[model samples]
Target: MKPAHRSRRRGAPAALRWPAIATLLAAAFATSPPAAPPAAAAANPASFAANCGTKPVTLQGYFETGFPGTVELTKLFTKQYPNVTWKIREDPFAVITQDAPLVLSSPNPPDLMRTPQITGLVKDHILLNLDRFYKIFGWDKFPASDLEQLRVDPSGRPQGVGPVWAMGINYSMTGVFYNKALAAKVGIKLPPATLAQLDEDMAKAKAAGVLPVEQFDSAGNGGLIFPLQYLMADYTIAASGSVQPINAWVLDQPHATIVTHANLLAVEHLDQWIKDGYFNADANAVPYSTMMARFEHGQGLFIFDGDWESGNLDHNFPGKYGFFLFPPLKAGGKQAAMSAPLTYGIPATAKHASCAAYFLNWVQTNPAARALNVAVYGSNPGGPASLPIPPVKPGTVTAQTLAAGRVIAKEDGAMGFIANAAGPIDAEAWTPAVQKLFGGQITPQAVLTTVQADYEQELSAP
Candidate 1:
């Protein structure tokens, strides 16, 4: 589940206003038909305003209310085009993930919606294919892997590869958040470059009577799962010639199974961490918020989380903390970690499809929007390869995260969340089996066997 209280930028209030897009109208001088095709109407603010005419367009947008970037961007969009009204409905991601298909399938679906339920939405033909807009807005230049997350085959059986069905406004990745003071206290000089070094650091922290790791297992076991998923990603991508088998398995492609050597090792490592007391003794008892609160209070040496927490870390901890992506087992191995798009897609039932598409394109093509994404959202707007990385303020956690994300993105090593292999896979199989492993109720191999059974059952059903 997406955390609700992750809104704060730590100690400081967020600066919500993002940079403005530079005006770049292709239609000028004695252009015959304009050298390049005009940018999508929604992407160009002036054109959208002029084309909107006198009709008042209330864009009904369904989004996870917790996302601050969407809200800030929407405010900027509406301010520029007052004729376009926004009727934004906020909902929890869990509710949206389960209910989005039915809502999108309804006759009067919202014009633009955040689609987490990619399975049913694409299968039901609810989302618009964005291939055309991709060309028009020059989105083809961004990393294909980043765009692939939104892609789905015609049948929607596998995700993360296929035609463009959605667009992400920004990108995020999973990594480790370290308390610098605690690291020094534990006699660690640099971030670990290999799993062996990390194990040593955890041992040092434990020996010094500090919590080696602070993870909240009571809610979703995200603390345990995120790092475990990252390690599995590194193994799967590096150890195979065809990452397809593993990739397909994670997406629940037909005949995919989680019972593999790499996955088994990942589970074994987590079990060992539990035995070594790397995590809090009462980890399963603490909620996610309390986990973050304790981390902020410097109770632990490391907290494995995504760049989504960069904003909070910057505002609260500032120079006191540092962030790094989880290292591979081999010192020089290709690094892989879980990453997801802050994605948005237009529904086929959208009344204002053009307007929504324009908004999507603008966030992507607009420099100001990209800057806002980096600055306010603490996320990298996976822009065209030609576009230079935007300026993130120096000496901030967001800057540190962006630097680490660039390294992994360059290696083409980012992967999808392991739990997202199937919609029900996490709650039904992964979480329960993980809890059982923590409680000694199951063995490492049994955890995979149990989750594999759920994967087969879910994917096999019509």
Candidate 2:
């Protein structure tokens, strides 16, 4: 979920925004290729440091406000390289999703930016392709799945193919987070091993008068989608033995559909949970921060969220929480979760594009930067698989999440967020649709059909 920050403009309707975005991108990029550093920088890993130059250079950055990892890393980089400094503007993730096109096409774009949906941006050449840096930095040595979501073909249809367009400061994964004390009170001695066991656990929590699940589903940022997608992964894997279908749907593969038997079953399960009062009654009104606050204050037994909050939970209420993957359908089924990079990209028009790319590489490979990423962000500081994950204190929530991320890596079950299926899909489609579902105004099938229709319409836009 995005941090709560004031949006600069009311979100423009997708119908109105896409045509304007396409026109702006055409004007911004035209036939010009993205700028690159000297050929020597591409030829040798040692020479890549020279691309930023020794002069005083301040890279302009656009970042999401809530996460401290990026800001901290910028300060560290400046300390290490006194010749470099940063000028960063931070906003909530929702605003960035709505404003990415205008921001990327501006005359003086940020040298580095947190990217939203990139199919349109990549197709229009608004985002700089990072294939050159990929070779120079040997990022290919990291797990291939770590970089797959950032790759885009020339036409930008299928996402997990072709050249890389972005890099992650850290890779994040989402699952179930439970209050340890609350769980024992409800008699859930172990994390559920299957969907049936999970259902029984929620029932026990409800019977004990504990709020079963603390979730958020406000108008623009629906957190319920986290569990919904996890359920989808469970059902999909149970039936087909893989989550590639769901990933394919997220990546915008040809003829891919979210209206599948697995997805329908997932939505139905979510609906049943809502009816069983597993979720808070006023969940529709709650924002991400409110849910976080409520769960930390010991109001709920469980909350579904991402590893980004692991560090925060560890700091605020140490040793009180536990993390687990949303259980699979059958006991031994392969587990999956919405896992992907906190992707940052350079603009085609950035003045310090080379320096921004250098920072991205350094974030992964530099020991200090990687440690900051792990300690502050509580995510996998994605570098080569051989690089040890910075030591996390045992029994901390960060430690559990890091270990869970390894399970995901070994299973190859990393999936992108369904909310990111398109540029406006979350704000305009999934969030509103899920809000209606929470209010009992829509059926389980309607949620899938409604979002799928909006997704198709948005993708087909000129």
Candidate 3:
């Protein structure tokens, strides 16, 4: 059964105007794009009006929305412009459904919102389009694959193109985190290298009184589930070399298959695991910390979450924490491909477009910030972390991190999409389905009724 969680999002307030330096584009440039794209928009980086009344630009946003990189960005942002006072708000991921309508309509709509690549933001027209801006400024500093990942429509356009909205500051990849001691205690000599083998290992662990896996709550800690779902989809995609949408952009594309039978096959695999007790009974209700505890106590063998959990592995699980890909169904799929490293979201009313863009651009280039951020997020070094985690591990998530960098120098952004970032469907809609699939309340077929219906509706809606 799913565990009890706190999905409450009662205090999610919209953006409040600040009294700092907010660069007004209209006044700044005589020739900047008049409004959004297709207006034969004026060029960006347009000079702001000297009359640019420097107001106290109060940035309304959250620090805990995505991964450690975004969190790192927040820290760096405060330092960049000490004069800009911030009224930041951090809330649960489910709040997208909890308070989306309220904030979208309220007079004091947040100047900026930190979302997890949600769909409704586009369907409801709540977010500013950054496609033109990102291109003009060159967010392509990373990889083409990474850029494509940002464009979840899978039809070959970035999420910011038009109806798509909300780019990421950063995102983590999904993977399998395991405790070596638990593997030994359960009499397993090796971690499974394939999805089938993973299931086999889980069954063995369960028979020996160990929980095969520790999955977080579908409510409060739900974002952690992305890895499991990601893997399931990947298993099928590997066979076909196809990408599915997690956002609504798939519908916008002339020809895109957001929900295919093969895609549904992935959901079925997860459903079978949940039904067979691979996860904790309280999997749907357990918070991330609680699941981590399971691994620490050596009662659980593995974790289905992001690579960002690496730093916390040692102290949390204690004995030995190792990482691996999602265990593909196909023998040799590029298991190295990850969901995302991290991406940033720039606001329409950003006062420091140049500064923000520069900061983002600098983040990709600067080693210190990227290194520091990777440490905090507990993720392995990707774009730049070429070596490995240092030996002197600390108790905090930051200390047990990798030293080498894994920065995507070639820039291949081909991440599929996060359901939250995909379509017009509210991110929460998948929860009940995910829950039902596990609890035996519904079959994967039943769950797809909602999943497919939503995917279709979101795709068709204006």
Of 1 and 2, the candidate ranking higher by TM-score: 2
The lDDT per prediction is: 0.76, 0.87, 0.52
RMSD of candidate 2 to the truth, in angstroms, is 10.1
Please report the TM-score between candidate 1 and the true structure.
Answer: 0.85
Off-target runs (Cα >4 Å) in candidate 3 are 1-44, 48-61, 65-87, 95-113, 118-138, 149-167, 217-231, 242-261, 314-319, 336-338, 341-344, 380-414, 421-428
- Residue-wise C-alpha lDDT for candidate 3, range 146-183, written one tens digit per residue: 45444433232334343224444444555566777778
Positional deviation of residue 192's Cα in model 1 after best superposition, in angstroms: 0.7
The list of candidate 1 runs beyond 4 A from truth reads 1-55, 219-222, 241-245
Alpha-carbon shift of residue 42 in model 1 (angstroms): 19
User: By the TM-score metric, which is better: model 1 or model 3?
Assistant: 1
When summed lDDT is taken over every stretch of 10 residues in candidate 3, the lowest stretch is 404-413
> In order, what is each prediction's RMSD in angstroms?
16.9, 10.1, 12.8
RMSD of 1: 16.9
User: Arrange candidates by lDDT, highest first: which order?
Assistant: 2, 1, 3
Candidate 3 lDDT at 238 equals: 65
Clashing residue pairs for model 2 = none
